[model samples]
Target chain A: MLSGEGPIFLQLAQRVAEDIINGTYAEDAGIPSTHDFAIFYRMSPITSAKGITMLVDQGVLYKKRGIGMFVAPGAREHLLAERRAAFRQQHVAPLLHEAELLGIDRDELADMIKEKDPS
Target chain B: MTTAIDIRGVSRRFGRVTALDDVSIAMPEHSLVGLLGRNGAGKTTLMSIIAGQDRASEGRIAVLGHTPFEHGPTLRQIIYVRDNQRYPDDYRLHHVLRIAPAFAPNWDADVADELVDGLRIPAKTPLKKLSRGQLSSVAIVLGLASRAPVTLLDEPYLGLDVTARSLFHTILLREIAAQPRTIVLSTHLIEESASLLDRVVILDHGKVVVDDETEAARDSVVLLSGNTDAVDRVLSGRPVLESHTMGAMTSVTAAGAADDSLRALADELGVQVARATLQDLVSAHGAETPEPLELKKAIRV
Candidate 1:
């Protein structure tokens, strides 16, 4: 599923974070070990560990002294808060930038967004 | 990182041709390295020198802190398996199975049996009687089952079909995860085996051109595309690895040209920008690239 989209580990981190948001892994539940992740993805264990480590650093997952990694409490909330903030930069900014380039005013842009809005 | 294999100023000359010229590479222990290069780029020569199959004409090599030459204890811990392995004309697969364990001190007979069965290789068949693909399978079984400290595989999946190649990859990675080791897999099927490598070493004209972590290697190049003049203006200052022009649209692979400034230029000049893959990097580095290989390409041994 990873096709040279930046680094493999960061891509893997994104997938794991997405799983947390989608409720595939419950908060406080232990995620797959690096070996399991490597086997499942058919990649190197070293690569998977890097991704897991990234999550650990981000407070998305916590590691016990000897035990494996577990989903942090409120990880979903943390991720949602992070993604919502990113939504403005990733999805909102491009729309606004294009609207400005096309000379579309504020009300017209809002109207266009509402017309095509899924909600 | 602890170095498992350290080679310095290694050179191998066959007649007038300098197969390996002042090649030096140090592989960290428990790392899977992909040794990649075009034909006659000295990958095989370098592997042979490190594995002690052939001696370097000049320079030094150390495996596990000891020189590997004349099949000593240091060499015993390393297994070199190539796609087209040759055995005595009289030896059969049965004989090889009986004797291979003696060479690999850490050999696992059960793993060998499982892989042989998994690959559906006929153990009763003579070594000379097996087909090319079957021979490749036999080599892979030995390489995996050996579980050696250092494993050198030179396109061991050359003739394997999609399923067989996938099986080899699964078995190889599983074994490594269970017991990490230094493995250098040399192959021309760059993209197919790209993900399996932790570190990648690229050779061109018998020299180590690029050696870096696989992630960092892929991130070093960027693709710029769009109208010819727009893309050209955006790519002007960058070192263009390879570029293609179809009609008025131009696609260029630029090395070390990935930055916010470049992206802004590409956008302002009406060009598109994207990341470059390892395959793109391989073609960009050196050597004339042939037509792009299919997703599933078999290297003929």
Candidate 2:
């Protein structure tokens, strides 16, 4: 699950954020502890702790004193908003870049997207 | 954080050959540090010195604030399971487990039993008759079950299969979390164990090559490959660790992070730029000529 570019902690943080955005963790629901993440991901406890701490700092996750970490309220919406804001730069830009190199015009790209849209 | 194990200017000599040369490392308590290097890179020698099994020809070592050699109290708090640990003649697995608690103050019988079954260590085979992997499993049982505050595992994964290795990783993470301790594990499997380490100490030719947090060490260099001219231009004057060229294609592992400008240059030049993985870093530093140890001070954390 951690096979990605950049530091492991950053990849872990991004994964948790994606999970939150996908509703895997409901708002205010408790998530696994740092140690749990370490064991599950086969990574060091320090690295897991750093990833969780980053989320806590970003208001995406919150600590409940001795209980454990929980998905902060509105965390899903916050992450969704953030992802949506960067969607073009992170996803569409790459798609368009590859399309241009393949000599595919914007109209053809739009047609391909429409044809692939199942719903 | 308190220092768990401290080595200062430690060097080990085997008659005419030098095993370790003026190596200094201070590992803080509860840190999972990776001691890595090629075979005969003095990994075993350094571990032996730290575990009090052998004395350094020069310098000093402190484990838990006291010298480990012949120091009973300090030695009791540390556990070092050698890769080729020997057992008494005709000793069975049960016999070793029975006597282990006598030496380990924090020994946990439940942990030992769990590991025995989990690793599928044969109960009836004599220790002397066990295969290399079986012997490794026995060592792992002792290492984990001891639960000492300071643990040193020298090549614990030797001869282990893929499934066995994964089980070891799971068990190690769980044990450390339940009972936090300082661990220094030496391994030849770099990428396999890289994720489990928060701190990394790489040695080459008996000298510390890179000592830093795992992520920082991986980011300290960038891998570039493509046309020879494009790669060279992107590298510019940066220090190259290791480089290979085939026909017009050149691949270079260069020191320093791939900054934004460098990335832009690489993109324009159609050269691939990526962060160096832990394995890449280790291999590059391993192949590098032995630079003066003084030059390595800049990479130390």
Candidate 3:
């Protein structure tokens, strides 16, 4: 599961975030252990841990003493907020610029969205 | 930066075989250093001596301002993570984590927790039951999370796949950036890790063949490829490491210049000049020359 050309830890962090969004790991569920991830992915544990540590630093997961890591409370909300902000910066502005070039107004976009799903 | 490791005329030997021959080098603090060589080229021997796992037959080694051997406080500050870490049969993944903090002074619990969770290491699985890749991962976690001032990782990514190795490199850079420390990495996979290293220390046979800043080391050698006659003309009077020829085409590795004169000479001879890689430089050192008597004498002192 490779993505962009950045560090492996960032890719892993994205994958774990995806897993959280997709409900693969339910709210408050414990994440996999470092050794299992290493064996399953055939990666060095340190590399896998780099991803997990990223999530912890971002407050997406919290460690339980001597137990393991669990998805933090309100993690999905936090992720959604982050995604919304990222979407505005990475997609919305670019889309607006493209739309301006194509002469597609906000009303046209709204109509297109409505046509795709009336509900 | 202060010197984290200061090796002065250090030498190690096993009976008639000389592993290190009076090699002296100083490792600056908070930089990623690459220790490079072919198999049996005294790389591991030198690392072992600095880590205090093996004693040098001669010379002096100081890690963090103290002699490494049996110096508990100094030894604790240096973590040597290798492919062959010994664990008892009954030991499990949790066992190592449980005891790592005692030795690693700067050990970060949060980093350890994240790593354990990310790797998905089954806490209950015994060390013997884990696969080779898993074992390598365990070592990586300890090495990184330990946060020792002088972290020595010798081929820590041997069994890992490309993705895993990439992840390791990324984490290493980020961690080192966040908490600067003196790191010594010994690996045959030089090209992949080349960019991460601030400097390169190359050992040939039992001596320091090339020790220089990464940029300087890369710039010291020039590769010229063209017609055999043309390459030979340009290579004449220069120290040639190795050469290969196919049909009318020949490539020669030589130590000389990246100067305009050399570039113009290569152009005149229809030879293409390229910077030599660290791997090429190591290979060109001629597979470690036979240890000289002088080096042996220096080691004894």
Best by DockQ: 2
Top-down TM-score ranking:
2, 1, 3
Ranking by DockQ: 2, 1, 3
DockQ of 2: 0.85
TM-score for chain B of all predictions: 0.91, 0.94, 0.92
Q: Which stretches of candidate 1 lie over 4 Å from their true place?
A: A102-104, A112-119, B288-301
Candidate 2 Cα outliers beyond 4 Å, as residue runs: A97-112, A115-119, B288-301
Error of 3 at A107 (Å): 53
Q: Over the true interface residues, superposed, what is the Cα RMSD of model 2?
A: 0.7
Reference-based lDDT, each prediction: 0.84, 0.90, 0.78
Considering the two chains of model 1, state its CAPRI-style docking category: medium
Model 1 scores a C-alpha lDDT of: 0.84
Q: Which wins on lDDT, candidate 2 or candidate 3?
A: 2
The 10-residue segment of model 2 chain A with minimum total lDDT is A110-119
Residue B151 displacement in candidate 1 (angstroms): 0.5
Question: Candidate 3: which stretches are off by over 4 Å?
Answer: A1-119, B286-301
Question: What is the lDDT ranking, best to worst?
Answer: 2, 1, 3
* Residues B66-185 of candidate 2: C-alpha lDDT, one tens digit per residue: 999999999999899899887888999999899999999999999999989989999998889888989999999999999999999999999998888998999899999999999999
DockQ for candidate 1, C-alpha atoms: 0.71
C-alpha TM-score for every candidate? 0.92, 0.93, 0.68
Error of 1 at B68 (Å): 0.8
